[model samples]
Target: MEILDHAFMQRALLAAVLVGITAPAVGIHLVQRRQALMGDGIGHVAMTGVGLGFLMSANPVWVAGAVSIAGAVLMELIRMYGRTRGDIALALLFYGGMAGGVLLTSLSPAGSNANLVSYLFGSLATVSEEDVVAICVLAAFVVAVSLGLRRQLFAVSQDEEFARVTGLPVRALNLLVAVTAAVTVTVAMRVVGLLLVSALMVVPVAAAQQLTRSFRATFAVAVLIGTAVSLGGTVTTYYQDVPPGATIVLLAIAVFVVFATLAAPLARRRARAAQAAQGAHDGVRPSPGTADDVKV
Candidate 1:
């Protein structure tokens, strides 16, 4: 593979696989539970952590991971209070996190303003071995947690109330989802950066859902989609002299859009045909007054 031949290419490929595996493994649950936007919020929160880490001359990944965990806890609390207004809570979390990061970066006395650009947009080309190690550690944590709790995660994802009725610890599972999402966001931030990290979590999952019926199948599809886009986008970035993060995000968006376009009409047609067949079976006669009535 072109992505494995060179050293940098190999690193990028490794990072892509790690990111792809973790992002969608956690993302499928997030999307199924309607907490998809939580990644975007936590990513921005992790940026604030990175910024704070820089200001304190600390390890950015460690600080970002810690901050993401704390932020995720806060998100859980807000969701508890705003259950009916979940998106509003998420939007507040996102902008609040971004603004906090910006304010901290600006107010910091030591670091150059240029440091902000790296976190805000991305600097994946400058990814060091240490960063890759951090990514791997976080990714491993995410994977271990996901596989360990797969059944509960799957049950809660499909329907929390039903899962609770069936004896799953619903609250603990909810918090588990939030924590997993936060860790996934932190890992993804390394390769895709803060602004585009959520796209990595979201787009591939969306594309995969179009083609898969089982949860396991969907997660597998998502990982495949994620790995392909990450590796392909890295190659494109090298050849085209483009920003790696932007290229990867664009490629993911393209994949999701393509799959969604193809799936939508097919799903609609199937639904319509099913409805027509049901109507025929039900023997519901319609007045011959309007065209739709005649068809009905």
Candidate 2:
């Protein structure tokens, strides 16, 4: 409760809540579609923005917001143009952004290098009211877009070619997915920082998918897992004097491992029960009779 008394901590908590909600929501689709690496790529690109911010003497979050949007759009374009190996394109953009950011930061004054470290590791204690507001706004935007385009996004995620054949604007929706992921990465960066942000975005979603069937149920479960990690990490960091970002990432990984292990046994049990049901059914013979048999 004392953490709430401090304005900075309260801001961190608020921003974390927003990040927790949006990151896993978008991440569910990414993981389902096997685009987990794409989220990592986006987060790396965001780091380049962080470096650019330090170079420009502006807030890194603002730079991250702007550059990541462009990066996301570019990812879409590259995927469209390349037409086959989008993952390679994503990797290219990620490294290019990181290289550019590093170059910019190296050109900066010696004393400013420490600023980049904050971006690398994260400093929730340094989170400001403005940072909180920006994260909240971005998270809200991601949520609105996700909800508004849920059906189209779902169709696209399930099968892009099918969605396109069905007149679902697959290309535009794909771009929207990239952009949404970028925004989610930006928000996650604030809480978990760029390095571990990808884990925060992914692990919880993976955990949730283990327990759910339908898309809506998966989303709900993911949110719960993410929220738990965000809040638990906050408390752990406060009490244990650990790095908040790393703590949160580790928490998420722990959840993923626990759930994944549990799911294996559950899946085995289900398989066994299904096999038993089939065996029992196979033991029965159908009554052979014509439909018009007059016994009735």
Candidate 3:
């Protein structure tokens, strides 16, 4: 409570909440497509944007968003047309983006290793009002795309071939997803850092899956879990004087463990209940040779 008195703390917590909501919102689709690491690749690419911002004396968030979106679109193109060498292409992109960021940061007169380090691992105390505004706008876009077009995105994510056959623009949707993911990476960068943004995006969704059987349920629970951990971690950092990014990720993992541990027992109980229902539906049956013989 005392921590919230600071303007920086308020901004950090707000950013954390937005990250919590938006990361999992975009991530669930990636997980559905088995492209969970796409966020990581985009995060890597976003580094170039951050560096470019520093070099040009611009807002890193917007620059990172632009660069990451371009990178994501390129990745999608590779996925669509470069199947034979997609992994190789992706590796190159990831590495190039990171190297480019480092190079640009080194060249910037106003930027230093310390400046880069803050974005790399996050610095909650450094979040500015402009950053919160950027994050809010970006988060709104992420949520609208993720939830508004859920059916179309889900169809495309689950099966591209089938979705195309059903008259959906699969390629467009795929690109949209890539773009949204890129935006999410940027949204989370300030709170979780570029290096760890993927974890926040994917882990909360994974944690929710342990307890949910339906996609909607998973989405809802994941967002809830994400929010909980983000706020929890933000608060923890205030008291413990630790890195917010690491604390948030660790808390998410801890929630996943708790959910996984509970899943096994819940599964067994559901199985037993299903068996009982089946037995009741079948009605009581006589033993092999006991009941019918008595009548005779």
lDDT of 2 by residue, 73-173 (tens): 89779877877887687778888988887777787654344466556666778788778878888898999988888888888989888998898888878
Question: Which segments of model 3 are wrong by more than 4 Å?
Answer: 283-296
| RMSD value for candidate 1 | 4.7
TM-score of each: 0.84, 0.89, 0.94
Q: How much does candidate 1 score in TM-score?
A: 0.84
How many clashing residue pairs are found in candidate 3?
0
lDDT of each: 0.79, 0.80, 0.91
**Candidate 2 collision pairs:** none
- Residues 1-296, candidate 3, lDDT per residue (tens digit)? 78889999999999999999999999999999999899999989998998898899899999999999999999999999997988999999999999999988888867565387778778888899999999999999999999899999999989889999999999999999999999999998988899998998899999999999999999999999999999999999889999989999999999999999999878876765565556557995545443333333
Point out the worst 10-residue segment of candidate 2 by lDDT. Answer: 287-296
How does candidate 1 score on lDDT? 0.79
The candidate that achieves the highest TM-score relative to the unseen native structure = 3
